[model samples]
Target: MSIWWSLHLRREAASVPLARRLLLGTMESAGVDPDISYDLSVALSEACANAVEHGGDGALDGAAEAYRVTAYLDGETCRIEVADSGPGFGAAGGDAGRLSAEAENGRGLYLIQELADHVHFGTEPGLGGAVVSFDKILKWRKGASPLLAV
Candidate 1:
């Protein structure tokens, strides 16, 4: 089948719920299983929240920076992309996967990588801004099985 679904909106934490609903609903309507749906929602929420909190002003104003979220589903594989119109981080260092039990933050990248089958962070096309994408592998079932699965 095809593999593309997208939604773009201005940066605001309040809009995160909207993005989550849209992304999760798209996967559900595309026939993704329930378990995959839950994972998608959780991962997307984290990505969108990071974008709103770090990329934009987290305001309701229309002039605020923009956040674009795109989701692609093909067979049992789902890919999600979250991009923002803001400056890119120079160098992503530090232990993203710290074992500390008292850390307040710095786990966004770690969680994304841990949960997703595949995760990537980079500058958007044409260097527009930052783009974070992750891929989810759904459980195979019935007639949805492909010749060779992931």
Candidate 2:
């Protein structure tokens, strides 16, 4: 069950579902349990949504025009990352501000923290942007792929 893919997509709201759909398709084909797949997909969407919102709005024609997403599934675990081209953490809507306002509204970052088993919130090295990464131990359906059974 070694599978991985990456995408460079424009910083747009629609890119969120496009990325999620791809992940879902991959998981479905791999015979992953639907519940687990849904959890990961939700986390992935939050990460991407954050990127689109805080990944900077300038430079539409330049390298900053898009964000990056990468997912890797190996053995019994799956890891995913979403990186933006804007300012990194602490500056993303201000960490303190977001935390304080958490009770009043839904924060994508917070939702991601709740969904994924292992999560990392950090800056993209040298790129000067936020990178949200997470991993979860995978479970398979009753008749999962032979590769995953081992």
Candidate 3:
């Protein structure tokens, strides 16, 4: 069974926890291993926080007021994508360099990279925004597989 959901949320602080909670609840109800769920939730939170803080590129057209979060559970993997209407990663969009320990920002992307099995950071194609997408091989609680008949 493949389960997927998408949310378009305002670029506000409260939206961060709201997205995290929905993902957590969905995973828990689906019987995903708690550890895996927790990891994904944390990564999701970081991604959402990044969007809330920087998703808007400071345009007067009001185009960057919201962001999107999409999650997909298929077979043995869970994939999540967070997209925002902003200036995007620009030239520093990849793992081109390491951040200093004293740096105040830009840690969320690193955290997401470390927590996810595979991560992809890029712009939203020609849409001119940042898109953070990652995937994790899911572990199901014994008798509670994501593939189980619902």
Best by lDDT: 3
* Candidate 2 local lDDT, 108-146, one digit each (tens): 777887888988888877778888899999898886663
User: Which is the better candidate, 2 or 3, if ranked by lDDT?
Assistant: 3
Residue 136 miss distance in model 2 (angstroms): 0.5
Query: Which predicted model would earn the best TM-score?
Result: 3
Instruction: Give the per-residue lDDT digits (tens) of candidate 3, residues 29-144.
Output: 87899999999999999999988988997777877999999999887889999999988877677441464434566787778878899988888987888899999998888777
Once model 1 is optimally superposed onto the true structure by TM-score, how far is the C-alpha of residue 49 displaced, in angstroms? 0.5
Please list the residue runs of candidate 1 whose C-alpha ends up more than 4 Å from where it truly belongs after superposition.
57-64, 91-103, 140-150
| Candidate 3 Cα deviation (angstroms), residue 43 | 0.2
Could you tell me the TM-score of candidate 1?
0.76
Candidates arranged by TM-score, highest first:
3, 2, 1
Q: Is candidate 1 or candidate 2 better by TM-score?
A: 2
| Candidate 2 local lDDT, residue 89 | 78
